[model samples]
Target: MLATTHPQSGMVATSRIHRVVTGNGGAAPSRGDTVELTVSHLTKRYGETLALSDASVTFKPGIHTILGENGSGKSTMLKILSGVVSPSEGTIALNGRAISPRTPHDMHELGLSTVFQEVLIAPHRTVVENIFLGYDGPLRRRIEKSARAPLAQALLAEISRFPIPLSAPAGELPLASQQLIVLARALVRLPSILLLDEATAALDYADRDLVFDAIENYAAAGNIVIFISHRLEEVRRLSDRVTVLRSGHIVETLERDGITAERLLKLMAPEAAIHA
Candidate 1:
């Protein structure tokens, strides 16, 4: 049984058998224990615009940061990985299996989840409903509202530092809180490859720390966390490896020990550095 205290009503909502990850026991390989995902020769073109050009990278079970300036194709690469857009060329492999995910649902079904900069939640729905949006079984079928609360509450508690009311409408909450809901929704899926595209852009200091802590814990549990942030400090603090992209091309892949804000900035904007 799953249960959580509703903030507004102080009532406990109960549920049973929540669908999280759709696999055997939903256990991912342990952290630092194996390679999880790989993207090879990825390219994306939007008419005459080449957003990402022949980019390739491998991800293991840890935090990996993607650093680049605007127009550097960082977002483009993330979009392809999240199945929001199809890559113009190249292939993706998950756990040694070549796979093509054509939609966000496809990616999630394959254990790839994403939280973008934009908060994508149904404002009018309760937080619990939003958290288990695409989940199979009872949650998706709307079989029993009582059976969804416990798992949703457990999942949210795992990722968020603050108390969130399971019964509150998401649209009524602040932007920061909505973003947290997005994170909660992603975590509930128990994805093997988690993509964060400027996910903390709207968060406050405390909220950001909470999100980071959740991310670290998630990665430690043997999953891949792909982070995209313009904040060099965040990249330095969270990344096990940093990949620099410039003008749609990969410039370098640096181990955590070798990553520095100055070096990353230089790689991200070579022309600016040269002028400076």
Candidate 2:
């Protein structure tokens, strides 16, 4: 268990991570956990404006990218999946179980974690605290308390390129580190479905590559990663399947071998491509 000192309450809180220990001294079962998410006829409306139409798609174990221009319903789709808002009409099924998550916490409990474009962190909190924030789950097969710090440290090392002290205040860190901390928070849960909405915008070339490598490994290990980014190059390099949305509707979904800069631009913005 990692002990976190709350600045406001002055109380020490204990944090726990999910793990399954076996006779071979094996750790949590991360890889080979097959997952599938299916969205059918999902729609969202804000008064008279339809933010998302009747959109439908399925995601398996791998990095699936959502592409679209501004107001193309990409954000709305993610919002619905993350339970930021309720869908006006639709059904979401995970592993063949129908679910309607009413809040982000609800979604988190259902094995879905999201790292939005916004950097969410308690500025005055320590790195360790922020990484394991809101960690409330079933204490089944919990690891030894003494081993928690090293686990947190290992997760940070996997995502961040630099050495961030566990005791350092999160607000004192740079934007890149802050973003990484948010990413670490999401990954700490070992979610079955990880949503990244422009999560790498704050990272530079090298740091982005490191995080990308981690994401690829996570997906390759039989987990689903929903990646949303406007950067074409990043999508080209990271996406195994690309879903294009335009005007609140899904335009197309292209496989890895079918993606191209020109084709993507045309699908995302045909008018802009014509003018150019």
Candidate 3:
């Protein structure tokens, strides 16, 4: 969640999150297991523009939804978390140890992975090759077609209920299939923190359900899943907690019970009170 001082109250609205654990068919962690990630006093600047200012929030093992209008610092916050960019001023800690990631590879090594809003895939690459793009080490290497095919097929089956050809060129697949492939690429890593920036925007209804189920199972296994989406209904459905950002500041942090669309819209755009 983004952070700022209250306009009239002159107080910082620090987020107070309550964890509610549910069983994903008994795959979820035990109720008291700790998987805390804290981001405090984060700020990012680009030349004269301030993208994020004083954003602070703590994420635990659950599905967290980030809500904001365009330029409200949503993507900036995710980028900082995913290690695509460094925060101008702030700290990120897992449990109690402070850590900084300077690149996407570094972030992944620290148990963080991201699926961005854009569809990213090599057009000429086969689905299996694209899924295992960077994991070329000896133990996990897929230098041969026969070796990669089975593992890629298994992962694709686990994430998507629909059938996708593992041998098809990525460019030849539909947009929805390509989106699933992107998700497969990330899920193959089994990162502790999965950041999804509008990941489901390109998915069809069935594929969306498949992805949401995968998200639930991932979070259930004691990992953190942070996502941003404009679809309020999907947010309400998938989020265990929802954080609203506005103008580079956090407006509200709501638990599952508080995440009504009307209330969320009201908090997101307080100036449009009549419509809210």
Sort by lDDT, top down from the best: 2, 1, 3
Give the TM-score of each candidate.
Answer: 0.84, 0.87, 0.84
Alpha carbon lDDT of residue 154, candidate 1?
Answer: 62
Model 1, position 17, has a per-residue lDDT of: 16
Backbone clash count, each prediction separately: 3, 1, 2
Q: Give a tens-digit lDDT track for model 2, residues 1-276.
A: 123343335554322223311221214433333578999999999999998999999998789999999999999999999999989999999888899899999988777899999999999998877877776446653444455556667777777778888888999999899999899888777777899999999999988998898888667655679999999999999999999999999999999999998889999999988887
After superposition on all C-alphas, the RMSD of every candidate to the true structure, in Å, is: 8.3, 9.3, 9.2
lDDT of prediction 3: 0.77
Rank ordering of all candidates by TM-score, starting from the highest: 2, 1, 3
What tens-digit string does per-residue lDDT give for candidate 3 at 38-136?
999999999989999998899987899999999999999999998889999999998778999899888776667799989999989999888877755
Q: Report, for every candidate in turn, its global Cα lDDT versus the true structure.
A: 0.78, 0.82, 0.77
Q: In model 2, what lDDT does residue 175 have? A: 89
Error of 3 at 205 (Å): 0.7
Distance (Å) between predicted and true CA of 69, model 2?
0.9
Whole-structure CA lDDT of model 1: 0.78
